[model samples]
Target: MPGDVGPLAVDIDGTLTDQNRALDARTLDVLRAWPAPVVVATGKAMPYPVALCEFLGIDSAVIAENGGVVVIEQADFLSVHGNPDAAAAVLADYREAGHDSGWGTVDLINRWRETERAVSRDQPLEPLEAIAADHGLVVVDTGFAYHVKSPDVSKGQGLETIATQMTFALGDTVAIGDSRNDVSMFEAVGTSIAVGNAPESVRAAADYVTEATYADGFLEAIEWVGTTD
Candidate 1:
C-alpha cells in the first residue's frame, strides 16, 4: 500500500496558506523532507505557483490556472485546452456592457495566460456560461474567481497527465483542496483530503477532512498519509 501511494497534489490558496496568504515555513520544510513528490495545484496564475515551487526548491509538476496550464520538472509550460483570447473577448464584451466582469487587478488582467481567462467571482455565472458555451468553452467557479476555460481542461485532467508522465497510476495519487475547483482533482485521485475551512460540499466529497485549517491541515494530511498504508 505504501508503494501504491505515489505523489501528493495540493491546492495553494486556502490549503497552503493562512489568513495572510503566506506559506508556512515549517510546512515548506516538511514538504522538502517528505519522501513523496509534492505538486502544487492552484487556481492562481502559473507564474505564482511556479515561483512558489522555485522558492520551495521542489521539482514536482505544477497545475496552474485551475488546470489551464501545467508545468513539469520546471520545463516549458503546457496549455491544456482552448484559446484564452476567445474567452478574453467574451469577458471584454461583458465589460463593455457595464457588467463587473474583469479580473481583480489590472496587473492580472494584463498578465500572460495560456489557456484560461479569469473574471470576477461577483459576475453572474449564467450569462458568462452562456457566452463561454457559444465559444466551446466552460465556466468554473474557483470561489475566489470565475475561470473561463475549455470543458476538457481541469485540475483532474492536469493531475492525470502528470501521473502518466511520471509513470504512476492515477489511483496512487493523493489530492487535497478546499474549493469547488478542486472537486475535479478530488474525483480524479484515489485519496482526497479537505481542510477544515473547506465548504461543506468540498468536505463531503473528500475521503478525509482535517481538524486543522490551512498549513496545519496540509501537514496533518501528509502525516496521515505517512501513517497509512
Candidate 2:
C-alpha cells in the first residue's frame, strides 16, 4: 500500500541469494529502494528474516518458518501459526530411525524456531513423510531444506494475514519465490514469479518465470511487478 505495486512478499535462499546463498550488493540496493512494503518470506527461523529486514532498513516485516511466524513492523503485531510440539514429535520419530535432521547435533537452524522444525534435504522424502504423517505434520520441500510443520500452516496463510493488516487485497500482492513451498503463496497472490533455477513444478505454479536465476531473477521479478497489471 506504500506504493503503486502494493506489498511484496519475497523468499530468501535461492530466490534472493546466489547459488552459494549469498546476497549480491545490487540485490540489496534494489530491495532497499522497493517502493512498497516488502516482506521477507522464508523457511528460515524467526531471527534470520528479522535480522535481514533490520539490516536492510526496511520494516521488520517477515513470514519466517514458512508461515509459522509473521510480523509487520512491530512487536505487537506478531502472529504465529502451527504447533512446534507436533513437529517435534515428528522429528523424534525421524531421529529414532537413525537419520540426522541435517543440522547435526547442535542445530542452529532450528534453535530459534518456534512453530515448526526444518529437516535437511539429505533425508529421503518417503521416510520423512511417513514419520510426519503419524504426527499429523506435513513436510514442505523448499528446494533448500524440508520443513516439518502442521498442514494447516503455510505461506499463503501468512500472506492473507499480512495483507489484511497492511490494508491490501491478495490481488495487490506480488510473490516471488523459487521452490515448491511457494506454491501456496502463488495460488493466493495476484502475481507469482519463479526464478529460472526453479524446478518444472515450481515454474508451472508461477504466473511468470524469470529467464535469469537467483538475485538477478529477483530483480527481474521486481520489474515484472511494475509491468504487470
* Residue 101 in model 2: lDDT: 86
Candidate 2 whole-model C-alpha lDDT, 0 to 1: 0.86
lDDT of 1 by residue, 43-159 (tens): 777788878878888885888877878878844446565577887787776666667655565647437777777787667778888788877788887667788887777888888
What's each prediction's TM-score?
0.88, 0.94
Model 2 agreement with the true structure over 46-93: per-residue lDDT tens digits? 899989888898888889898989988854599988989988888888
Report residue 136 deviation for candidate 2 (angstroms).
0.6
Model 2 regions more than 4 Å off = 1-3
TM-score of 1: 0.88
Lowest lDDT sum, 10 consecutive residues, model 1, at: 101-110
For all candidates in order, the CA lDDT equals 0.79, 0.86
Most accurate candidate by lDDT: 2
- Where is model 1 more than 4 Å wrong at Cα? 1-5, 74-79, 101-105, 124-126
Instruction: State the displacement of the C-alpha of residue 220, model 1, in Å, after optimal TM-score superposition.
Output: 2.1
lDDT of 2 at 130: 92
